[model samples]
Target: MGKSQLMEKHPTGKVQVRAALLPLVLGAALALSGCIADPQPGPTDGGNAAVSTSAPATGELPTTSAPLETTNASNKAPVYWVGRSNDDFFLYREFRDVPDQENPVTSALRAMMSEEPLDPDFFTPWQNPKELATSISGKNVITVDVSADAFNSNLDADTADRAIQQLVFTATAAGASAGLIDSNQQLQVVVLVDGHTGYLGFDHIRLGAPMSRSTGMVAPVWIIDPQEGTELPEGVVKINGRSTSPGNKLRWRILRVEGNSDKTSYLSGEVTASADPSQSGIFALSVNLGPGKYELRVSRILSTQGDSEVNVDSRGFVVR
Candidate 1:
């Protein structure tokens, strides 16, 4: 399809001709899933954690070139950020409120490059680009055109790869969540720098080729609700998060912040994620507490033979 045809198909806005040439790649299947759960009051010591086992939905791309109307009135979109767990870095996500005028893909990329993550542990190496836009083809390929300034951050090869995958995951998640793309098919993302290809990313990975989500790029465990520095009511506090280790035991601890950097463990226990291998690891538990500053830490329970290194995610919040 040509630029004029893409514009005619998407009448909502004029298509920005940012790329001199668009590259196409074979599509591969990619599965993206998230867990949503309502917290139910349970024992604080060791309660039955709620798990979401909902099946993944497959979406069909609209036949017409017109832009797909999104029913997500909340204006919230998913944006992935890079964070460290143990010695390795991984991608973490946050659902941010975006402008309604922008499509999910654009909103997500802009946020990923410019916005700070809700969790202090998460950060983005991407500098805000002076120009950025995104378009999706019928083949489920998303093309992103961004300014070269976005790659200003200095990073090693491995970190650069994770940073690029951060964009891929965010764009795909945004499209899937908005029902703008066909989720049943494999999706790929191609990034362009200032209407051209072959731009080196972070002085490391070369751009222009189609990229998909890389394995082991996502954090093993992440706290989804009660984000960092959130304030909650002084009653039953519900904690929710996701884990990559499904059917595995997760150890959780609630620490009371005593000083500027000191945290004394208040409550600790273990909860098992859903045993169903098909479902994403969604775990939820609640604890009643009085008003105070606290932190929630969660990590997988490794066996004796496993490496001593642990991957953990923690969120600091206040109960008022």
Candidate 2:
């Protein structure tokens, strides 16, 4: 347990949380832990499906698209798929069973193309025709070639922009996680339609440049540890997420949910986030609990005025 400080705002944007005692300020015993990043949202209302488009006559595997090396030792791999909500796009993780040897990028993209999300809140606007191929280069750039149907995403420009991000974020994250991209480096991707260029989406984003993860395009906070649904062997769990913190601070809470009611079980004692505000700060805390089932939420107040939560991520899990 350690003494923590609360940062109080004074109408101006700048505020600092300190270790000094302040009356009526939120405080408690706290322990720091490690962090990681990565959530879903509800479905869109009246969202349009991608319009069908005729496949180009030239849609074929390219000469440079050689057969990918298969690493058949693992039966399953982690993959990311993009799903749409009315306001934003979220990346959801799913484990896919693969042959002993398969290309990581191909495995992930096939899942993205062929499957619909199991969660109700998420939907993919792209109609997967299974005419997709993938290859990686030395610069860690992944090239995803799909049939002309890839360009048939009928979403509005804003939703289409998010749809593009959905593809970029899902492929990039899945690539790195599967070790196709170096873990220490960021992943970039290029989408190719029908073995050639000259294809554009509703967002009008050209396909020439490599794409990286833009955090603003997705949910701000994700529960990075203990995963989404797992049986905790111990009473204590390490919780972490990525987000821009207000006044250099982040907050977390654990609630025990019984039947239809929620009860507060633990409040993080003023744990601060990683100092980098430009990047989503890494916030972490270790909490001990005697629980059955709990809902964990991590949030931060980005505004100085009303103290409303700007970004929040939640997860539900059971503890034994």
Candidate 3:
């Protein structure tokens, strides 16, 4: 819906998407969305990009279609996972269930798509998605029967869009042109479910085509209680965060305590999520703040392509 706060070249860079940004873009209608930043340039390939970006390409849909059967393998489709770092290969999970019929994953994807159509790229469908196409001929309906594999994807929303675009691009290339942003049965995506509202639905529900690509400012990090500047409630203060983001990419760093609001420091230390999941999981620094006034400055590190402090939600808590 909106561009990342800070866009670098590598995607290799970082983008700070705050919670406040989502409501404005999502609005009332939930549809597929897309993101295009200022477009800084960086490496063409690398797993740890910093800019935090996404791109859509029209891929080739294989000819001679086959049956919509189920299989238990990582049946990833052939997509060009562009970018330098982690944006290389995509994962197409093959679920045992189908999407066109009753299923939980289908219901969630459909519900989110219809209600929040602007963000249809929220969830991924079954594996080998393009192969599960259906043509109504005279009718305008094209059921997107996804398999059980999609439901199993606990991937955050951002990461979800990457996979969705790949599937939509390929599906559109193939003859299933009946599906699109318009038309009632124009595009229907279905999947299996538990029968409830959550991911594991009670029964199942289906969706149409056109997954959304809304990547607004999401809550990338949660600075635990006691706040950042607060001193040791436990001599060994625990620094941890409950993390979830689309790109499977979201990292924060503690750039040493700023001597003053001027935002300058004589010395600084750096830590990345990729380096230590436990340490990077949360921006924690146990160093003493001394008895003088100081500011806790944190940096948003995308893979290899970003250059701005997306967020600085630090407070003045005491060590006493």
For this target, which candidate reaches the highest lDDT against the unseen true structure? 1
Q: Candidate 1 on 1-320: residue-level lDDT in tens?
A: 12232112125332222212211121222122332233334434353333332333333222211112234546689888877676566777778888867788999899898877777667776778899999999999999999988887656677677779889999888898888898767788999999988999888889999987765566777777887788998777787776665445667777878768787767676656553433344567666777778888878778774723267888889987
**Compared with the true structure, what per-residue lDDT tens digits does model 3 show for residues 137-211?**
344333354444333333334444443443443332222221222332333332212222234321232234333
List candidate 1 segments past 4 Å from native: 1-73, 259-261, 305-309
Model 2 misplaced stretches (Cα beyond 4 Å): 1-101, 115-123, 150-153, 182-187, 261-269, 276-280
Q: Which order, best to worst by lDDT?
A: 1, 2, 3
Error of 1 at 196 (Å): 1.8
lDDT of 2 by residue, 1-320 (tens): 01111223335432222222212211211112233221122112222212111111111212110011123345455545443322334454545565535466676666665665433334455556548778888888889887866555444455556567667766665566566776445567888878776677644666757777554454444455655566685355666554433224445666667776656554333344443322233455555555467777666554474655544556677777
Point out the higher-scoring one by lDDT: 1 or 2: 1
lDDT of 3: 0.28
Off by over 4 Å in 3: 1-218, 228-238, 242-267, 274-285, 303-307
TM-score against truth, every candidate: 0.74, 0.63, 0.26
Q: After superposition, how far is residue 298 of candidate 3 from its true place, in Å?
A: 2.7
Clash-forming residue pairs, model 1 = 18-195, 28-186
lDDT of 3 at 34: 16
